[model samples]
Target: MSAPPFIHLRLHSEYSVTEGIVRLQDAVARAVSYRMPALALTDLSNLFGLVKFYSYARNNGIKPLLGSDVTIANEADPDRPYRLVLLCRSLQGYRQLCDLLSRAYLAPRVRGRAEITRRMLREVGVDGLIALSGAGAGDIGEALLQGNRVQAASRARFWEALFAGAFYLEVQRYGQAQQELLVSETAALAAEMDLPLVATHPVQFLERGDFKAHEARVCIAEGYMLGDPRRPRPYTEEQYFKSGEEMAELFADLPAALENSVEIARRCNLQITLGKSYLPDFPTPAGVTLADFLRQEARVGLERRLQQLFPDEPARARQRAPYDERLQLETDTIIQMGFPGYFLIVADFINWAKRNGCPVGPGRGSGAGSVVAYALGITDLDPLRYALLFERFLNPERVSMPDFDIDFCQDNRWRVIEYVRQKYGAAAVSQIVTFGTMSSRAVLRDVGRVLDLPYNFCDQISKLIPVEANRPLSLAKAIAAEPQLKARIDEEEEVRELFDLAARLEDLTRNVGMHAGGVLIAPGKLTDFCPVYSADGGGSVVSQFDKDDVEKIGLVKFDFLGLRNLT
Candidate 1:
């Protein structure tokens, strides 16, 4: 009915590793319902949701504020970590944010949560970034609550000097106890220091009632039972996405904070270019372009293959011109499309695996249709003999990444990954992170337990859920397909309640897992493109972005597939 009063400037959309429960799509829907013009994603220690959040926000008629709730190294005490909310004001700001987050993982230190030191931050330099005096639990706010106002003021001033005019004192009122006290003290300090103020909602879920399901998510993440106060329980029900009016009323006395959020949203101007193909460069010899090198290699390999495949001179002669013509045609298409590097890169790894006695498949999928692949030893198929279409592999019309699903010997795939890391620099390569969303049956078990329903009861209801042949059906679809599930829902009230809650909690992120074979390689250290994360601070380093978004932002994905049947 009226102009939106405020915009949410701090939100964690499941990309906060284990802590966030809101999916980016659902968060956007909630923001749309609030009729707000802008929203922000400040996922902890990573920008995993940045590309998708930004793209989706724009598509949904909202300005997306880019920020992170990064865990920073406490310079005075390295053992203790402090969290800060950093938001970007421009393209330069986004780059700085990426560099800062990248160094957090790249630092030569013992593995733990990814963190960058103040010294590292200074080296990277905060140019277009806006620093927030992280409201409650932020360095400044926590220092105030801990009765270390001197430290709080020092920290605030340090950020103010670093951020220059781009800094603001972040005030949030999420119905927490010490929030008002922190806000009052921080506001007076900001006035004394001439720092601006901005209000944030710090959302974790779409609605307040989703807290129980969110709690189940936390328990599922940390291996804790509900009410297990000994473990980390950092969020409250108030962390839900509040309406702009609700937030404005919460900080009614300090409208300046609310207005400043709008100002910050206005300053943030990010333009993400989607659907562009970004492949990693494969190093060629001096004075040789990848296109030229690939052409030379494929031609020689094809000639040698023809001699071997057809031992008779007359038979080989018959195959020669057609094979050469097909090879030239495919090569032209690849070179014209700017994908010679992609072909060369795939060939190198496959050849590496084959040389080391690791079984490499001839080729699978549409890639089998290319004669150039047969020449390069990337595939064994003779496209001419099979009458396979070259357009299926590298179409002149299709504009997408030419995905070569290379299957390596099941056990030796790790060696290939390690080789890539060593050659490309460990920081340049990372396995893609895949999220495990709470599925229909899964939510029934999780929410059922949280609601203190018996295990047998939960299991019985879950078993009634149908499993389709190709893809699993949704709860609604399953209920429609299975009469037993419908009958149970109609007969028992507890069953109806469980189904109700499970349906609501379904599709929220439950856990993080490594993608089966998807690995991302960058031209430089990956943090320049996207942040990397780990399962327990070490071991397999995974790209924070998933399969689709990983490609959307321009990091090339190479699926190093492993199949026993291929061998």
Candidate 2:
């Protein structure tokens, strides 16, 4: 195939914690619009978007260059992390990249950022990897700008030897004065060191028109004013998805830099397998099969429950036979659907909680509708006695894993979690992550605060937005529905700017947070399927994917909720 003039190799999707503004769907659409064959996602320091990016790119017949802009510990100033660009050249590179990511995040906490030391690169092993001298903010470029050409050259040679055949000098033309200096000095350094030059357009948003909203997002993250000159602007409006011809002219004299982006695109081919369940194996008794073991325990529990509920033989005859029939039918459906192990695991944990004297909730959610749960002692509610429909729990029409919402005494929940952690292995358990988005109401308040408007003024205007506990109105919808909101926007220029900008900013994620009780028990180490990060840089590890995403990848979520009323 003929070489395309350029391809975007440095991009920050929405997953890049607070700075990037490009949505995954919109990024794919822009690639299609340009008729470009490939694009890359280097979201901050994590591959949080890798699975979605790879699948979407391959499905749309576009190649995805998988990589990240890693924040490595600075040798000179350990507190300040130095940015470095690393891309995967093959599946082996992806694995090594994952290894590096896990170690850095799991390391002891740092005040500002998570990072791996530059010296540790050898141990991580850059076997099937490609390295880039990152943007002017990166280690090498910063060294050059500080007039330390020797240190910059030494750093370049270090990476050149580290990545072996795959190191490239990255030159980005984003309209900075230092960029020209970086290019001139880097071109000389590249020639001397025999490194190839690759051009990358540092993309933060989808289009040029999105600059205002993107800046506002950066301000919200960094807590700066739009007019604040103390903080330097790291990007320009020119950093958008550019066409091949537009980039070709940007580097007309050094065409090899543009051509090498296409070359880098050709080297990356990542395939992510989606939708496979990774449930752990329940330890069955020495001789029994998992299905038979579950059946035996459930039957024994049923007989004990039967005797307690119906003491007289005459009552046993009336109740026992029907309860036995319901148990058998539910057990048959569970085993046939290959969920015997699922049931056994849930029972083991609930029984352990009870043995340890934790007060467990009787039943909650659709799983309460199953007689199997009652017989296994996972739920105390009797389905037949309560007349709860078994079809609602595990329908013959829809065969899926049944979820049980278990509640432990609020104080004892951790002991129960500690027991499970010890039983299943700590590496296998994690809390799920959830995103906090800038909702319609939230964006108005945030934009008002940063714009330095008065609290009463912001509140009075925001109150015009009609919202409910479950439902939220979009800014446009609010303007249409409320005459007062519409009149304020029509008459006041500040109000109009606030409304316009807030609308663009709404639905962008604000921060990462923990799901109250959605704990995922992976079959093995979670890195086998996805990445994990500490919530707020401490406490339990969280799956980068949220509850919905966790289910898609086959990690069963057990909600061990805490109830306020119980407290």
Most TM-score-accurate candidate: 2
**Residue-level lDDT tens digits of model 1 in 306-355:** 98899999988876888888888999999999989888888888888889
Cα deviation at 503, candidate 2, in Å, is 1.5
- The candidate 1 region of ten consecutive residues with least summed lDDT is 103-112
Q: Report the C-alpha lDDT of model 2 over 303-353, residue by residue, as the tens digit.
A: 878887888979898877788888889899988888888888888888998
The residue pairs that clash in candidate 2, if any, are none
Winning model by lDDT: 1
The TM-score between candidate 2 and the true structure equals: 0.93
Candidate 1 global lDDT: 0.82
